[model samples]
Target: MIYIYLYRLPPNSLPRMNKVILVTGANSGIGLALCERLLCQDRQIQLCLACRNMQRAEAARSALLVSHSDAQISILRLDVGSTQSVLKAAREVKQRYNRLDYLYLNAGIMPNPQVDFKALFKGLFSRNVIHMFATAEGLLTQQDRVNPDGLQEVFATNLFGHFLLVRELEPLLCQPGHTAQLIWTSSSNARRSAFSLDDIQHHKGVEPYSSSKYASDLLSLALNRHYNSQGVFSSVICPGLVMTNLTYGILPSFFWTLIMPVMWLIRVFTNTFTLTPYNGAEALSWLFLQKPESLDPLAKYHSLTSGFGNNYTQPRKMDMDEDMSEALYKQLLELESNVRKKIEEEEQDTRAHGQYLNQTE
Candidate 1:
């Protein structure tokens, strides 16, 4: 359910400028890498690191201070899985920062990941797999969790929560005379097999993580179409294969070490397998330096590394169904409306209780 309020721009103000960039999931991994790179290059730029864990957020801020002591970094606790948390965090950010220049919606999760080495080994010799798994290009696995929203954990955490956050922060995003960019981190693993419009949440036994990523890809495209003219520019980026904490969770720590040689070998053939966090953040870092109007609204930008380990952007056409995306958007809007009404009802009940207490006193 994507709720968008359109704002008509005056003919005089066509170019909107932004000075602050907010990134979610900035406590570690590629998010942290983007924060460091952005802060190092621009002294005046305000970088807000939005994370779920306060301790990790503080540590990330401390680490950023090492390179740029005077970096304008703010930590906002945002658990995208929870609607209440997202709204509260948005309100707090709104109070603190009047206008947002860029929003890097990079916070995502692939929980309870399990690798099928057997499938990988089979794929090595077999030519049957038309769509390759992200890790080995044959098969992948995942562990399931029930989300706070009573949806599949991966779908809720990875897509729905972010969807809600964007809806909640719509006011701050469409600030006049400011071109706000919503950059989403998508993946090459977003295959057609992963997503089913019939069972979008992946509750009917499927690779929920990949399904969620595919949904996000569609959602971002839908957002761009609906809101590009309203001072909101949406873009999605596939950061390629990066060895990060999320990937580490899929396999044992020793597995990453043992497969280092194989990974390096693969890097020779396709340099997009960025072995380091520094390499992974290159595309996201590049976007921060780009003008909003200069960016393509419909194309998903891919972050790939060259043979020399240099970063570059490659435009890829996504297999997106416009009808499915619009359907998802409508469903989300209904969910949002119901959720908002529930919140309003709860608030009214609390207020009524308070008045009753005052009268009794």
Candidate 2:
């Protein structure tokens, strides 16, 4: 059985003109679903889809246009895994919009994921079955690689790139007298045990995806601490066990199809089995209409679906501390400085080489 959840804004709560919202990985899944929900609530808002592939981005735009024919939509080419691409996209955003109202950091990756079938089967008979299924704690692992930016691919794509994007667009996001929301598509798998302060990129860990997500949770708290006075608020959300392309990569489609009924049965025990993308995007769309000051910085909002097919958003306290979050923030700032210096040096070298070649010619 499929469940559909519909949301409508109060008549007085409709958005004003020139409210700009940008979403990374907006081409599909929860990100795309969030976009559609946002448009449904407020058609006057300017929505920008920042995706790595222009072709997929165009297709997504067309799909959205089919529903809201008069909605204003724009596309930006952004690969959050690549530093250059992120920097370039930030510049484009600055040129196009004077202020950004919401920045959805949703692009993420879990490369070469492998399911531990033995562990899964073992957990099925154990008392921790529901917890295991909800968080995928011991049942999944991934073979992570380093991106061209010399950072772990999972960390770069999931956490660091979004951090860099926030820093690049700080002027627009931190404007006085206006509040901007930084909503991250975090996960229930963001366990405190998975993350290490000594290795923020999870260089020596098998669960880079989990570590990166934990890092994001910490970073959101840190952002709230430092930027709340400047009107920038950061919040993270767990989309539950949504069967997106990322989830499909873990197990076969037929297997998930076969277990569809079982998943629904599991939902009675735990609301985390929000299997569809639209259901997973519940908390994301909910945050769009909230007052930032009323939200708890340390809480991780979750998308939940009841067995009776009711959808709602719940705020759960994350397993994190202010001190650790601040430390991670400082570390990220240092890393950002080093990355900028390295890029500047490389750019200088490239320019010098080009001039040398011109002289020789």
Candidate 3:
């Protein structure tokens, strides 16, 4: 069911110099589609796929190679939900690349998703049916749990882990004489009411997915405020209502198939139904071709598709205040400090126990 169009260039083509880009969760869905589109745009850039599953990463790389055989593509093992993995991946990236041009923080999760069918059915007949389908507002919820890092799984995977990676890679991202782009794959479901400064992790909420996405939007603005002067610019984009693995989890595959015609009908009313991954990546690819200085920090660029299959990117103002964004940034810094100290203590204890066992033997 998947098709990859082969693109070939002149045999004497040389790779571009110093254009290293890293994309997390690059093995599938929008991440993989973005990779394909990027290579199709410029096959010479150095691209690294940071994925949790190496086997899948390899498969993705092979698929990309079918079209871009001579392109510079590499794989990296990364599990952004885990603090230790984020730290390790950052170190590996530092050792491998001197400067990073673009970082696509596209990895995210919505574990144990549940849809309120009553709400969905009622909304379908309401005036806000298009809006509900576009954003899934008030219709979806998720069951989140704590990861080994002692953080909410959705928060850790969607926002905090990427924050830590950015902090660790500041050296590469904020290099002199060059501007780096931090592009977050945020969502339209991100609502101001879902996120709270005190409960940033959404520990007590069923809609942790929404809260985490909203947090990412706020964090992007904060990053630009703090790091823009240092040659690092941050932006967020929404891929619209794409049918990725995450979407499949919401309903059965057979159910989605049955509703395919209805979805297409809805697309005529709402451009947010970018059902395919390629269409979903329109905004992401559009951003790649844009100047970092020209983007608005307060706007979220969205991928929109017309009923006639036309694709475009649109930037809409987000409902957030600068003061709250700054406050959230400060709290994240404090959390990072506490996490680091805890990790150090755990390591020391582990080493001591190992030494004791060796001595006893």
Candidate 1 weakest lDDT stretch, 10 residues? 129-138
Model 1 / residue 348 / CA error / Å: 4.6
Which of the predicted structures, 1 or 2, would earn the higher lDDT when compared with the native? 2
TM-scores of all candidate predictions against the true structure: 0.88, 0.94, 0.94
Pairs of residues clashing in candidate 2:
none
lDDT tens readout by residue for model 3, 1-361: 9999998887668664647899999999999999999999987799999999999999999999999999899999999999999999999999999999999999999899899989988997888988887788889999999999899999999999999999999999998898999999999899988999989999888899999999999999999999999999999999999999998999778888987788899998889999999999999999999999899999999999999999999999999999999999999999999999999999999999999999999
Candidate 1 lDDT over 1-361, as tens digits, reads 9999999989888874337888999999999998888887687788899999999999999999998998788899999887788889988988887788888989888887777888866764655432243433447767777866566778777888888888877887887776888888887777668788788888885588778888888888788778878889888888888888887887788877886786676677675677677788877888888887788766778778875788887777788778888887777777778877887898899999999999999
Q: State residue 50's C-alpha deviation in candidate 1, in Å.
A: 0.4
Model 3 worst lDDT window (10 residues): 10-19
True-vs-predicted CA distance for residue 361, candidate 2, Å:
1.4
Per-residue error for 128 in candidate 3, Å, reads: 2.1
Worst 10 residues of 2 by lDDT: 11-20
Off by over 4 Å in 1: 1-18, 124-137, 346-361
lDDT of 2 by residue, 1-361 (tens): 9999999999889975568999999999999999999999999999999999899999999999999999999999999999999999999999999999999999999889989989987987888888888899988889999888899999999999999999999989987799999999999889889999999999998999999999999999999999999999999999999989888888888888887787788888888889889999999999999998999998999999988878999999999999999999999999999999999999999999999999999
